[model samples]
Target chain A: MTLVESLSTGTGFWNPLAWLIAVLVAAVIVYLIRQRGESGYKKGTTQTVPFISGNPEPEKEMVHVRASNLYWGYLDALKGYYNFIVPAHTGVLNDYVLWYLGTTAALFVVVVFI
Target chain B: MFWNLPFIAVVALSLIGLATIVIKKNLIKIFLGITIFESAVNLFLISLGYRAGGIAPIFTSAPSTDMVLATPQALTLTSIVIGVATSALLLSFAVIIWKKYGTINTDEIRRLRE
Candidate 1:
């Protein structure tokens, strides 16, 4: 059978190609809906200010809040639940690596056992 | 029953995740939506690895003629790794946003630095 003829009918719901197309369509719809009637600046705006290496310019309407302050507000609202959460305040990349390792190990264990 | 159940669950989970990300305004919740999406893909990959009346993909003497597919297992592993990296990167950006504006609300964020 030719490849064209084979793919003529539905490949069934279980087909990976079908699933991928579904995902792509969903993503496109979401993006288009988000883009409707919005200014170009808001559409592609980056929240973070780009850091130019070693060139500190005049700050224009830039608000720099302390990391501690931000964490405190989020945690304060959490009340009893705040103690259980791990705060990702450390600027070091190693902490992220460790988090990835821990979560991956835990997920692997869960998948293997059940 | 097992052969088709996973496919149905994956599709359902994908729809749920897509809805969550599309409807939710909170950045953290959006990240959770992505996590859910990744989970659905992982489940799909795992389902693809299953084989009826088959043994594990291990080489042994007198091994069963039918062995579970190995490619999906590899794909699942890669998906999990990529999921971890993407989540970490997104969460890190969330942290930076919180530090910058002292607010996690996406609506509130838009009002600032205009």
Candidate 2:
């Protein structure tokens, strides 16, 4: 259990105690910084409203960002890849099973041949 | 044929599960399919450890005889724990999705795409 002397194990090694100490130091630093920062946030005030260059605030639903919209540019760039992939994820359970069966069948054939 | 029954059951169970996952439209049904799939895998693992007239690998007073492999049982236990956690997490996600989108239909939960 006390393998921390050199921590090497032929191929790789890890020191749990060292990692714990490092994490503790990092947490302390973050806590100190947060404690020192100005706490100027006030609820139900103009400060609470999101800044949008004086534009009228959008509806709450419109203002909220959904997960799907987060990667528009990346998805657009890889449109071809997504075109092939997204349809495959049609959210239909049977199609998903078909994919799994197809993969298993392919692997079985490969293993049998090999 | 009798000895091979468990292996055949594993295949049947997994295939049925896959079919359910592919054909089911309800989120809960899909989840049930996943659980079935997990059960089939667990069954397969447990079956691999079977031995004729083998005793459980306990170190108690009984004279040590041919023991069923303990590794697969241990692995199956771990898998069951993981499966429970996974199902809980997935179900929670489903609940959250329903609350946010007012539906549990995978097809309709495409808000991210917008």
Candidate 3:
């Protein structure tokens, strides 16, 4: 098999060995730095507890970060876009199929006409 | 009449799949719709290379009649494998969603939205 060659039509070339070497070098640097860092973790101490604005920590389940709660700031900033987009997602299976059919029909019409 | 049969079946199968996807609320039903859609696509591809009485491309004896094109079959095989993987991944995600949210209803699972 022809391996590690540039595309016949493109100028870009990729070599697997080069990528492997680069990744290894980067990993070694990260490993060395991590080894040198202070490992001051102590069990059964206040240091082990997560600090939450000086307030007593809530129960583990209560404090668990749910997937939906993530990226709050980003979502808030894009509230206008999400308002239009989120409702369309509806998590409805039929809606998803409708979107696909609509797109396919649109493409068919476009291809036939133009 | 017979020549257009597969093409008609392809369109019907895909339309049925799309309808199923749109009308179904259960996650498993939606996945089944996806599988049906994939089957329709694979059928369409295989039909594209159909010959009235074509022989397999593999040769072990003297040269004979024209063989059906192999590329589309290869592509359909690859697509089938990918579809299996995608369906498995989607079902696993469904399981995870049920575990985390205690329900599989898309509307009820909208914890990410404000």
Candidate 4:
């Protein structure tokens, strides 16, 4: 029985074969959609180079992207939140201890209340 | 409530150690606090298996077979052995930190470094 073949956890059931078939079907649909993409796009050329006001693309290393730059947009959006947090990180030993103790106390409070 | 004295002591020692670790800036003091906390944990383990009028877990020709659980005692011994090694390692780290940084003050040590 297909239903009996599923792994059950009382409230939920999962069949790996069924999941694989669904994923395969979804992949086929995605492939069909990709076929309708822009016809002007070529396999490999300067046309594929990122738009930089029609200027020659620089080398990969010349880009000089920092690790922090990867999350620049996210950090910029959360500037207000970081402004409050950055100043609090004094790196003082006592402050670190207090933060840990405070967190532990919070956990204990949650355990007792919940 | 009379039988809960050891448990209460375990709680008190743990809290005191945690407070010491949090409030103290000195690395040596923090290590001492860690030792205190480890001792508290070991005591807690020993207390868990305690029983009145209990003899050693060894199979001796005793009148009654009332023996406390030996597993917790063994675990406490192992904890103590590990605690000794941890204290030694932590102290060495503190020594290295002091040698490299000139000052042992945690606040001063947080200065910008290349």
Candidate 5:
């Protein structure tokens, strides 16, 4: 009812006013931290180039990250789960349909019986 | 329950349509499923207007005035028109996708495909 109070969503509440204040506070904190960033590195020099784990940097042309490699760490951490899930995504059309129907039937059974 | 057979058919058709969309990889099949879903909706609208032994909503019938509601029929007509447009657009997109990708499998259309 009030501007500062959360609006009830029946299952949850959201307060735009509170979120706005939080965002403003976070922005101020970020600005302060940015002010502390070291400007010791010379611009338009070798110092501007990215350091590769204390090794010589590769060619600037090959500096880009591949799309699949972007999530390498996350995928490695969840390798066990991904092992089952990723292989299950066989490019075959029929298998995907089977999965969809299987999930729907399972949910229907659960909803009806439980 | 026998009297509500059309309503049951509507539910079944809707579920089938949804299953087709989720399970099928062929873009054309997905469009067909969309059409089926739209038909199910149209069937639902038509069924909702039905009265026991009711004749068509033509006032000029000269029979008893116990006729099915006409508003839902009009709504069904509008729905069919929209469905036709949607199917056309969907098929056109499917054609374009096939031409560009050379395959219709959804798995092959993945963004991270190396």
Candidate 6:
């Protein structure tokens, strides 16, 4: 069979070529939109800072919030649902593995029983 | 048509994701790139199960399984839900970063420990 015939005859919905074309079109559109030129900045020549009459610059101090404190706030807001919350992301490899495994199992069950 | 949809979707998604990562400076936008890739993979998986004449897998007074493939639909749902969760978590991280640094640009968020 000719290549054209092969391409046209097997026009099933599950065609890989069609998927590829769709992906290509989407990607190209995104790229094109992103590449569009930005409008010129319209900033005034005067670069004077905003005046806070009489008020000082609040000590120019850096406020550092501890990770632990942040975690506490999040946990408190979540209440009991996500009790095992932590102060910082551990980036733990094991945790990721466990999460993926659990999700896979859940999906499997859902698909089978759905 | 059906068989090619996923392939095209994946390619398109990959391109979009890559463009997002390349062009966006905001941490949140970068995270969006990852999520875009995730969506593309999910679409590919769903496309994998597409059948020209398969019927929906619903049990209620439904048509025969002549034009539906239940596996892809179920998997797509699972992936979409997971995507939502991941997006929420990423957004939370973005918020925290904004609070800490008062900016979302990756270049400016260098104060925190790697």
Interface Cα RMSD for all candidates?
A: 12.4, 3.9, 3.1, 3.6, 4.8, 9.9
Which scores better on DockQ, 3 or 6? 3
**Model 4 local distance difference test score:** 0.86
Least accurate stretch of 10 residues (summed lDDT) in model 1 chain A?
A86-95
Which DockQ values do the candidates obtain, in the order shown?
0.02, 0.19, 0.24, 0.37, 0.18, 0.02
Which regions of candidate 3 deviate over 4 angstroms?
A1-93, A103-114, B61-66
- C-alpha lDDT of residue B49 in model 5: 87
Stretches of candidate 6 off by over 4 Å are A1-114, B65-69, B112-114
What's the ranking of the predictions by lDDT, best on top?
A: 4, 2, 5, 3, 1, 6
Between prediction 1 and prediction 2, which has the larger DockQ?
Answer: 2
Q: Report the C-alpha lDDT of model 3 over A1-114, residue by residue, as the tens digit.
A: 567553454667677777888999999999999999999998999998789889998988997899989999999999999899868766555566678879989999999999
Rate residue A15 of model 5 by lDDT: 91
Score candidate 2 by DockQ. 0.19
Task: Please state the error at residue A42 of candidate 2 in Å.
Answer: 51
Write the residue-wise lDDT of candidate 1 on B4-110 in tens digits.
88899999998788666756767798788889989999999888877776688876843666676678889999999999999999999999989997976655555
lDDT of each: 0.74, 0.85, 0.84, 0.86, 0.84, 0.71
Best by DockQ: 4
Count of clashing residue pairs in every prediction:
0, 5, 1, 0, 1, 29
User: Candidate 5 on A1-114: residue-level lDDT in tens?
Assistant: 465788899999999988999999999999999999987867799787777778987886688877977888898999999888887767655566678778989999999999
Alpha-carbon shift of residue A23 in model 3 (angstroms): 42
What's the distance in Å from true for residue A31, model 2?
Answer: 51
Per-residue lDDT for A1-112 in model 6, tens only? 3332324455542556667788999999999998897955567743344456855535444446656667787667787665444422334323443466578779999999
lDDT of 2 at B45: 93
Tens digit per residue, CA lDDT, model 2, A31-109: 9999999999888999987799999988889978999889899989999998897776665445555787889899999
Per-candidate TM-scores read: 0.46, 0.56, 0.56, 0.63, 0.54, 0.45
Residue clash pairs of candidate 1: none
Per-residue error at B3 for model 1, in Å? Answer: 3.1
Q: Ten residues in a row with the worst lDDT in model 6 chain A?
A: A87-96
For candidate 3, lDDT tens digit of each residue in B62-98? 2775666689889999999999999999999999988
* Candidate 5 lDDT tens digits, B1-114: 887999999999999998888878777887788899999999999988877777888888649887777899899999999999999988888788789889877767664421
